[model samples]
Target chain A: MTEDQIIAYVDGELGPIEALRFERAMEADAALAAAVGRHRALRDRVASHFAPIAAEPVPARLAAMVDPSSNVVAFPARPRRWFDAGGRYAAIAATLVAGLVLGQVLPRGPAAPIGERNGAIMAQGGLAAALDRDLAAAPENGAYRIGVSFVSRDRRYCRTFSGNAGAGLGCHGPEGWALVRFVAGSGSEEQGAYRQAGSASADVLEAAQAMMAGDPLDADAERRARDSGWRLR
Target chain B: MSSHRVAWDETGEIIRFILKAVDGTELRTSDVTEFERALLDLLPRLRRFARALALDAADADDLCQIALERALKAEAQWEKGSRLDSWMYRIMRNCWIDEVRARKRRSETFVAEEEGLAVGEADDRRIEARVELGHVDRAMAALPPEQREVIALILVEGLAYREAAELLDLPMGTITSRLVRGRQALLEMLGEAA
Candidate 1:
């Protein structure tokens, strides 16, 4: 049997003719049989490792999303101004922003997404608010595009963003949205996604992936995070 | 009576209505039908497949959400006679590749991607099941992305070879070759055989 056929046979990928011939050869050859055994064992080992996630209870956010009832909700208008001084919230999920702003209404548009405070990089203006409340695809138009929200290995909530503010990652901590890594933005629309444009995004994503301790929050979990002011227990 | 302002919830995440229509329009569940239900039923498996692709739980679900949104939007276009699972997997895999370009990965060492999001593994049985799961998780994580994808679809998810090949748009030989490379790499990392 060819090497490919042998592997395919173990994977049950071989055609019947190929599988039959492979079996004959395997019986005659102990080393080949042993090799197949190892391959199968490894397959079983790896499959079992990942299979539990499937068995795990589906996250409520995800389950709610696919429910025909939840999926059919009206597209309430998108708010232009996410932050305002009035007692009323201008947008959905603005209640989560109350604790974030600390009762002081922040101004709009002028402040850049990245700023140096206490000699450390911090997210300013809309970027700060977006990191605190924005979902992955939500409007961060006033500042930058928030790509992915993940818990850093150190358990701090971190996010990746690109667009006018430059492509990089920032983590939320005592100092607010502290910039962990930064890459110069090309300021291109397609590149704004922090993906698929070039090696720059790959670098940023690698950093995010390295820093992430677990899966990034799905929408519901992100909402829950925002609801609780992103405090990890 | 003409206006139907959708009330935003206090938490403001779950939309409170499924078929509420505006302007006193007749409410309908026509959008859901069989497509949405089938999509919901396949969610668990799709999440597994997506997790295989995205390697992060939240990213996988986000990827899943995007794909589902697309699928629901294009429900009429789906060939109903075909397997919904395969079709949805196709959408998800394409969505993952297109949106994030989660490609260009060259790592061959474990970097700790999404570890266990164990839901009910605390019992005595799961503890036994987890004895080698960590080691296996590391071995699988050490593989190059290409090999890992094949291994995930074929060996881990148990898709038929042809199904995986067609879903990925690769030739039969190419699929087998990737399976071979992936299997050997996995075995090598696992220290089962060369």
Candidate 2:
């Protein structure tokens, strides 16, 4: 087969008749078969390497840009009055107030001594040790439970965790584990409860999805990340 | 079938509204609301494509942002019956090309960073296989941008030759040639790494 025919066949670009003819020729010729196999393998390898990006959560900033409520203010201030006139702005305002109130009223479990350094959340004491050494595959059944670990779109090592304090996603950088977003009163009451509960709340899940650049690291990848001190470099 | 027709009609109405808005005519709030909702649904796919086209995660997201902004501004240019996703992809490709040209004008240096694929010194075969995939990611980064875009669209994003050609606004022969060259270059890179 010519080079174009080989590429066309590998890409499934050939019509039915042509593909059948190519297949018959491959059966009769070893070199042709080898060429086709190589191209197929190359395509599969490329696909496997990049396919994880599809399962990643869309970033929050991009989502906000497309959301009508947010984009109304983004356009021109004058146009937003239309939304306000329709009462939609009022409803949105009410929701925001309710959210803020709930945020203050929610009972977050015993607070961990987590601090901030260069804008990243720095874990101290138990939280620090857990983030530094804990593996998701082998849960400690302790104060914190590690969920999915992934590489963020910014190439940072990020993981989802839940504890008495709250549930959220955090990324490890030079300073420490930066808490990207945390939702209070959403974490499992206990390790056993978390397993039974299946997953974190929708809000926490959405936060995790927004930061994930690709698929959650598999068991081996997670172990490797932990072993390397959760460093992306 | 009837639901499909309904969706098509709704899309048609939205397009008309978009055209009117583009021409500085008054638009209904509902029209803008409907368009935003549809665009929101396409975010995940657009992000995936952006990730494939860009060199790193941050750059990928920046491209997505630019593409979304352009798509919003040029809403009226989108043909009613054409695939919105494909149209968005084209906008993204053009935006990337423009950035590339601008970077070239500035004489920015491109550096090939070491692949951060190192794992603990374990002899386990599974760990080794995963590391190999990491190498593939790095190898993909080393490809030239034009060839890389072909691999991204056809192999990574699973767009067909015809669809990718249409999206890139290139002829079928050019698409096929780039795909062939990209596959060869990638295989060679992987072989060298091994």
Candidate 3:
């Protein structure tokens, strides 16, 4: 066989037919036989070189893939479960320790927004538009009127409204209308702005209530309510 | 009709058992359970493959441990009905490559740590095994990483040619040629040793 054909055979690239042809040729040629022997030896050496990996125990860290419960403690971000009161305390202590480790041991910043910008008790923006266009037009119905308003003993003006949308009070202030407080009114609360209006007591509304007693705004009183800055709640 | 009914009954019972097992655990946790089971089942195979890739027993075990950790984390991404064994081989290959890279980066000189090779060791039998293993390990480590991975999977893990090709994401011809070259290289490397 030609040297090229022998080389192919040595590399195991020969198919059955080509291999047989090469085999027959090698049988009669000593040099060709030596080349084939060398190739075989190369193959054996290669196999033995990497034949040891199949007998070791997989490491525990990797084995934890099967059982996270045993290994999860190593990961600090994951929360642990507490099955009892003691467990709960332990979990809390663990959390505090972890927090200390993270260097966040105290309350770091203002947790809630502060409220002194503009007294929202009065009408403002779309609310001011609503009050201007809609408030007095339906006063006889009393459904959306501020329940009462007057200059308070503190000498600050305020007004409270029974929201047409539900049960709650909104007050008037220099910035426009700020809702003081709201209680969720049942039934059809979803239908209008009053839904959220009475849902939570706004700081403005509470301050307005603290300023004024009963007896709501007349046209002149309402105008004054919209000009003067309401004071601290 | 009665024979068909009996076969159906057996099938129903098998399905029932599978359902109960699956239902007993959260779907995510169930996969974890299956993965752990597969790891335990594949431990011996993993060791064999590691040994083939790493020359020393301790190094091989270390490789296995790293491979197992990677496989477990990646287990969630494994699709249902995929072959876990092949998934594992790929993980092992990557881990071995990483360790090789790390060692290279550290420029760490590794002396063959087989205690059995130490001169004048008291334990003859243990030393003989260690020396033999150490020779094989040093020879394997000299091969290029690509060739070594193919050899470990095909010759050591005993994966089929097509399976190894798929696992390595290589063409069948590439796998065959690599294996052939790898085997030749291994033999040449070992033959030079005593």
Best DockQ among the predictions, by candidate number: 1
lDDT of 2 at A1: 80
Whichever of 1 and 2 has more DockQ, that candidate is 1
Model 1 complex DockQ against the native: 0.15
lDDT of 3 by residue, A1-233 (tens): 65435535765557899899888888999988986676555545545544433333344454444543322222323323211223322333233223222222222123211122231222333334444334342454423454445566544544544432223334444454444333222113444433332223343355455666565567666555544443424
Question: i-RMS values of the candidates, in order?
Answer: 15.7, 16.4, 21.4
Candidate 2: which stretches are off by over 4 Å? A68-233, B1-32, B108-133, B192-194
Worst lDDT 10-window in candidate 3 chain A: A106-115
Q: List the residue pairs that clash in candidate 1.
A: none
lDDT score, residue A11, model 1? Answer: 72
Candidate 3 residue lDDT tens string, B2-61: 011101122222222222222321111222355565566676677778777665667777
A-chain TM-score per prediction? 0.47, 0.48, 0.28
lDDT by residue (tens digit), candidate 1, B36-125: 567766777878887766555576788878888878787788988778988887787778656533222311123235234221121112
Cα-based TM-score, every candidate: 0.46, 0.50, 0.41
Q: B113, model 1: CA deviation in Å?
A: 23
What is the TM-score of each candidate's chain B when compared with the real chain B? 0.63, 0.67, 0.66
True contacts kept of 3: 0.27
Ranking of all candidate structures by their lDDT, best first: 2, 1, 3
